[model samples]
Every structure is written in C-alpha cells, then in structure tokens.
Target: MSIQRRHTAQQLGDCFKVAAELALPVLGRQSRHLDGLTDIKLVHGIVSGQGKLSGLRFTHAWVEGLDDNGVKYVVDASNGREVALPSDLYYLIGEISPSECVRFTPEQARRHLLDAGHYGPWCGAPFEHEDPVPGVAA
Candidate 1:
C-alpha cells in the first residue's frame, strides 16, 4: 500500500531539526534495527510546493531510507506529522531536483553539525541567491 501524506494544521518551518533528529539516530546505528532499514541519509535541498513553502525555492531537509526490499523512501516529520513516501513520489511532490540536493551520511551529518553548530544548509546549499526569510535560518 502507498503511504498517504500526513500533516496537521501547524505551520511547518523546522525541516532541519526534524530531519536531523530522524536521520541521526538511524545513521549512527542507534536505531538501525528498529525498522530494518539501511543506507539512511539526510538530504538537504531547494524545494517549492504548496503550504507554507509555496512559491518559494527554499532549503529543506528530509531523511531517506532503503527498506528490506531495496525500495527507497522519504521520511519527513517537518509539518507536525511524520510521513513516509516513496522516494519518487516525495521528489515529485516537492519538485526536488536530485542534482541540487546534498545527501549526508550519519558521520558527515554529525561532523558538520559539530563544526557548523547548526542543523544546516551547510556549504554549497543551493539557496545562495535567495534572501533570508525573517525567523528562518536558511
């Protein structure tokens, strides 16, 4: 069965924190056995779609994991709900271009979080030309 989109009325802007929390545990091997997933990663990229982020190509974060059957999925808990979508569907809905995304392994995420001191857009994020939104750390 296909996973349906799950979200609440809450406005979503904390993609980084949510994604990091979900990714770190699995990537660090702290919760790997819980779901039988592998090759987990934290993905950061520019996205544009409906809701709060509509009409803007802003930096966003999410986690990706490969299931036992080798199918990839995107797990997002940013909008006050946790939803897991097939990778292709997630990318299509978000209008995410793979070439513009940066994927981080557990080790890289930890190192970057330590060195940068934040969840991040990290270096080489695609939002260089976009003006920063007030109260948003992108």
Candidate 2:
C-alpha cells in the first residue's frame, strides 16, 4: 500500500469511529461499560494480506478495549463487561484490499492532535506556537 498522507484529527477520528462501530456487534455480546466510553484506544497495526508486509502497509486500528488473555475484548455497553472483538472485523472503507488501510499510530494520533490546535474547536486553549495561558499548564 502506498504511504498515505498523514491524517488529521477529523480524518483519524473518523477512522476510529469506523473501527468502533464494527466492533460494536462483538461488544454488544459482552460489556455494557462501553456506554460510558471510558477512553478510546489507538493501537499497533498488524500484517494480513497479500505481499510481504513492512512498516506502513501493515496497519493498525483503534480498539475500545485492552488485550486480555490472547484476545482483545470489546466494550459491550449493554452488559458492562469485556468481550473479544476479533481483529478480522476491521477493514478500511473503499480500499482495494484490506492491506491498503492507512494505519493510525498513537504517535501519529498525538501529532494529529497537536496539529488540531491550528483548527481545532478549543476556543480557550492557545496554539503551542502562541503564548501560553497563564496557568493552563499545557
């Protein structure tokens, strides 16, 4: 897969929502705690698809739950417990193949977030390039 131009917050968040929705079915059978949305996760991408994979081609998806045992349990929200969300359930939209998924890494996510300040909705938090708020301690 070609290296995708880095994603912005809206772009990456959209992708995360995609992975989250797909996981919902699996999560529905396990925990209701997902309703609370404790936090969202950005995790490592894995290799699956034609051709030898390296770096970017091998992608990652954002998951809602942590890895427990050998499998990743998802947030059910309806039941409030963890259920395994299969890795196979994730696939990028409109990609020629699964491998084309533009993986979102945590570091990339951080950068996207930092960049968001330029156009993000935080009306009070100043951009990093600008003067700091007296006590905000960002």
Candidate 3:
C-alpha cells in the first residue's frame, strides 16, 4: 500500500513528542539512545531537489520506519516550512548522510530544527524564509 496521508503539524508534532519522551530516558543511559526512537528511525540530513535546479538543497530532520504494513516511509516533522519533503520528493545530498542518523537530546533536536532553517510555528525563529537554499551575496 502506498501511504499518501499528509501529516498535519499537530500530528507530526506528536511524533516528535514521542521521540522526546523516549529521548529523556536515554540521556546519559547510553550515548546513542536517541537513534532508534523506540520503533521510529530518526534521521537528520539534507534532501535535495532532483530537477534542473537539483543544486538546490535543504537541511532537515525526519523520522523513518515501517508502517503497519511494513512499507517504509519518511516522516518529516518540519510542518511544511522548509519543504517537509517526502522521500520521493527529493534525493539525499551532501556529507549529511541520512543513513548515519545521529541521536540528539530534546534540546539539541529543538536547536537543530531552528538551525536547519525551519519557518514553522515550532521553529521559534523570528524570521521566515521561503527559499530553503542559503542566499549568496552577489
């Protein structure tokens, strides 16, 4: 089954909540406690555009694992701010490899969300930018 359900920010937030809850116990318990997120695979990396402007890239954090049917899917909790890209929407890019997902504390995760340039409500950053790509001065 091809899962096409788009998760609302609220729903996605809950996913992060679960990650945070699971995260609390792992802190200091084990160094890589946040990696698996119980059943979810949390990943932080860049997913890039595959079209002519394929040079365009985005830095993001996402969760991936099998659904009830065992179909793997990528869950982007960024709330569409910086292209909450589905796995199919873009290909992975840079040294920020998704295959090597790193676990972060709740606080670290929050900072990463903001640092990755999220423009949504959870980001708490004062500014919002439509373009995910960093601007270069001419």
> What TM-score fits each model?
0.75, 0.28, 0.33
Ranking by lDDT: 1, 3, 2
lDDT of 1 at 14: 72
Predictions: Cα RMSD each: 8.0, 12.2, 12.9
Question: Positional deviation of 137 in candidate 1, in angstroms?
Answer: 16
Clashing pairs in 3: none
- Using lDDT as the yardstick, the better of models 1 and 3 is 1
Best of the candidates, lDDT = 1
> Whole-model Cα lDDT per candidate?
0.70, 0.34, 0.38
Each model's total of backbone clashes: 0, 12, 0
Local accuracy of candidate 3 as per-residue lDDT tens digits, 73-124: 4544333222233344433432344453454545565464446543221333
For model 1, the stretches where C-alpha displacement exceeds 4 angstroms are 1-12, 26-34, 127-138
What local lDDT does model 3 show for residue 128? 17
